[model samples]
Each structure stands twice: as C-alpha cells, then as structure tokens.
Target: MTLQLEDEQAQKLPFDYEELAKQVIDQVLGMEECPYESEVSLTLTDNTKIRQLNREFRKIDKPTDVLSFPLVDFQKPADYDLLESDGWEVYFNPESGELMLGDIVISIERASEQAREYGHSLKREYAFLIAHSMLHLLGYDHMISEEAAVMEQKQAAVLKKLNITREGE
Candidate 1:
C-alpha cells in the first residue's frame, strides 16, 4: 500500500503521523480483504484549511474532522475503478507503484477536540481517523444506519488488530 500524507496543520501531535498512517491504512485494507496493491493520499490540516475544503466540495461551510474523496467509480474497491465525474480524480504514484485509491483530508484541530471529548489518546484518535478514511477510500460509507454500523465495526476491528483501542475500553 502507498499512502502519501501532507501535513499542513500547525498543531503537532505526539505520534509519528507518517508511520502510523501507513499502519492504520494497512490494517483497514486487511480488514476489507483487499486482494491487490492499493494506494491512498492523506492531508493533515487545521480547521481553516479543512473549512475551505468543506465549503468548496461539500458546501457545508464547516470544518469537519475528516473528509473522504474516493476515486473508485463504484461503491466497492474490488473493481478499483476511477470513473471520471464531478471532482473525483485518480492517478498513479511513481514512488510506490500502487494504484491510487483516493484522497483524505483530516482536520487536526477537530481531531484533538474529538479525542478529548471521546476520552482517547491522540494516537488512538489519529489511528481511528486514518482507518475511517481508509474505509471511505475503499468505498465504505456511513450515510445510512446499516452502513454506519458496518463501517463502525470495520473501523473497530482495524484498531483492535493494531491494539489501538479507545481509552478505558
């Protein structure tokens, strides 16, 4: 797997984001039963940057903790199709030689707040966000209740595999 992370945030967490991001992505790919090589692009930014993105793409005008831009044409990574439509774009990486999955933008400020509110370590929060974004890259969505439940289970399983559990259980 190839994960390109661009950290544009001012807040510096304790964890090594580059390393942990790869581990979390691998864990999610394993959970999803991905057969071939995969790729993902991640960006760590502050609220302002994420807010700009949210306004441009989602038109929500709010900085969300995480945003997913999946490239797969269909709702499943088994095909890994890069259907050209809307703002979706796909490309290959010369470094890792892996197929491009999609892009993920994470708001560091929001993540910190969520970690505090959820009572988990910053590392655990990062792991969860990265894993959650990986699921989105693999065509997972939480728009519906059933899909949300399934995605939650998959995220939990990925975190469990890496021993990146939530604090106090």
Candidate 2:
C-alpha cells in the first residue's frame, strides 16, 4: 500500500508525512480480509480550498475536516474491477498490482481548531483523522449506531497502537 500525501496549506503540520503514511498503511494492511495492493491519496489544504472541494463534490457549501472519495465498491468481493464509464476506462488494480483505492482531503485549519477545542495535541488529532479516513477508504462506515460503534472501536485501537491518545486520557 502507498499513501500519497499533498500538503497545500501554509500551516505547518506537527507530524512527519513519511511516518504518518507508514502508520496508516500498516493499520490498513493489518486487516486480514483485504487482498489488493491499495493506493490512497491524502491532501491537506486550508479551509478555503477544502470549502471549494466540499461544495463542488458534496454540495455541503462548507468546509469539513476530512472528505473521502472511494474509487471502488466495497460490497463486491472481487479483487479488482476494470470499468468503462462515460468513455473513460477505470481499472481497479489487481491484487498483485497497485490499486488506487481512493482519495482523502483534509483541512488543516479545521483540524487545528478541533485540536484546541478537544484539548489534545495537533499531532494526536491529525493522526485520528487520518486513521478515520483510512478506514473509510477501506469500506468502513458509521451510518448507523452499531456500525459507528464498531468503527470507533477500531479507530481507537489503531490510535492506541500508534501511541496517540485523546486529551485527559
């Protein structure tokens, strides 16, 4: 698995991208069921840029901390799919090959504010968001109470493994 990160914000992030990427990839690979070689792109941008993206893609008309764009369907158990839509050919990489899983867009400004509000270090908050995004990339969802609880537990476990804890822990 490969995590391609792009920092487009002027604010400085507290964690190293290489280390963060490794941690995320490691957590993703820990899942025994996943078979494909995954590729994910993460972009850190300011509120303005993220707002534009949110409006354009989700029609939210506001900025959010993280947004996930999944490239393939999670319901199907296939290793990969080669699809042709709108005259565009999209190939889900084979299990042995590189598959573009999806993209995650994060807002550094929002993260910083949340860190302060949550009374935690920026590093911890950022890691949590990254892990959450990674789970979404891997087809984890929290649309309901039970699913949300499970996802939250998994996220907490992953964060603890990374030595990241919430404030007042």
Candidate 3:
C-alpha cells in the first residue's frame, strides 16, 4: 500500500508522517484479505478548510476531525460488477498497479483539541482517527448498532496492537 500524505497546517504533530501512515496501512490491510495493492491520500488541514469541506460535501456546516471519500463505490455490488465487466478499469492504478483507495482529510486543530479532551497523546489520537478513517475507506460503516460494535472492536484491536489504549482501559 502507498499513502501520499500532505499537511497544510503549521501545527507540529506528535507523530511523524511515515510512522502514522504505516500504522494506518497496517490497520487497513490486516483487517481485510485482499491481494490487490491499495493507495490512499491523507491530507492534514486546519479547522477552516475542513469546515468548508464538511459543509460542501457532508452538508454539515461544522468542522469534523476526519472525513473520508472512498473512490470505490462499495454501496452496491452492482457497481463493482459494472467496473469488473469493464475489465477492471476503475480499480487499477496506472502507476503503482494498486487500487485507488480514496482520500482522507483530517483537521489538525480538531485532532489536537480531541487529544486534550480524550486525555491521550496527540500521536494516539491521530492514529485512532487515521485508523477509523482507513476503515471507512475499506467499506466499514458504523451506521447500524451491530455494525458499529464490530467496527469499534476491530479498531480497538488495531490500536491495541500499536500499544495505544482507550480512556480508562
């Protein structure tokens, strides 16, 4: 997997880019059994930019910590079928022979605030958010109770592997 990271904010994050990206990639690939290569774009922005994105894409005028835009439409199997029938045109990345996973936008300001609120290091908070967003990229949704429980469990397991603990845990 290849992760292209970009930071638009001037804030000094606790984790380095390579370490954070590796953790996210490990979480995403470990949860899924796929032979195909994958790629994702991670952009760290400020509150204002994220707010604009939230309002424009999600129709919510507030800034959120992270937002994921999946490239592969996993909502319907028919969409996958359509792409498959077209000789897998949509899944392949020309340069790396990887599937374009999608983009993840994170608000550095929000993450910092959340770290303080959660009583955790900024690195742990960033890793958690990145893991959550990576799951979303891989078609994991928390819209339903059961689905959310399962997703949360998977996320916790990944975090635990990286020696990150949740509050009071």
Model-by-model lDDT, in order? 0.81, 0.74, 0.79
lDDT pick, better of 1 and 2: 1
Q: What is candidate 3's lDDT per residue for 14-114, written digit by digit as tens? A: 55866767776766576665456778889999999999999999999999999999887666411334445655666779877888878999998999999
Clashes per prediction? Answer: 0, 0, 0
Q: What is the C-alpha lDDT profile of model 1 across 111-136, one tens digit per residue?
A: 99999998888888888998888888
For all predictions, the C-alpha RMSD in Å is: 3.7, 4.1, 2.8
Off by more than 4 A, model 1: 77-97
- Model 1 — TM-score against the truth? 0.87
- lDDT score of residue 11 within candidate 2: 90
Estimate the TM-score of every prediction: 0.87, 0.83, 0.89
Better of 1 and 3 by TM-score: 3
Ranking of all predicted structures according to TM-score, beginning with the best and ending with the worst: 3, 1, 2
- The C-alpha stretches of model 3 lying farther than 4 A from their native spots are 75-87, 167-169
Minimal lDDT window, size 10, model 3: 75-84
Which tens-of-lDDT digit does each residue in 42-149 have in candidate 2? 888889999999999989999899898887665532233333344222435555466677888889899999999988987877788877877776677888898789
Alpha carbon lDDT at 117, candidate 1? 97
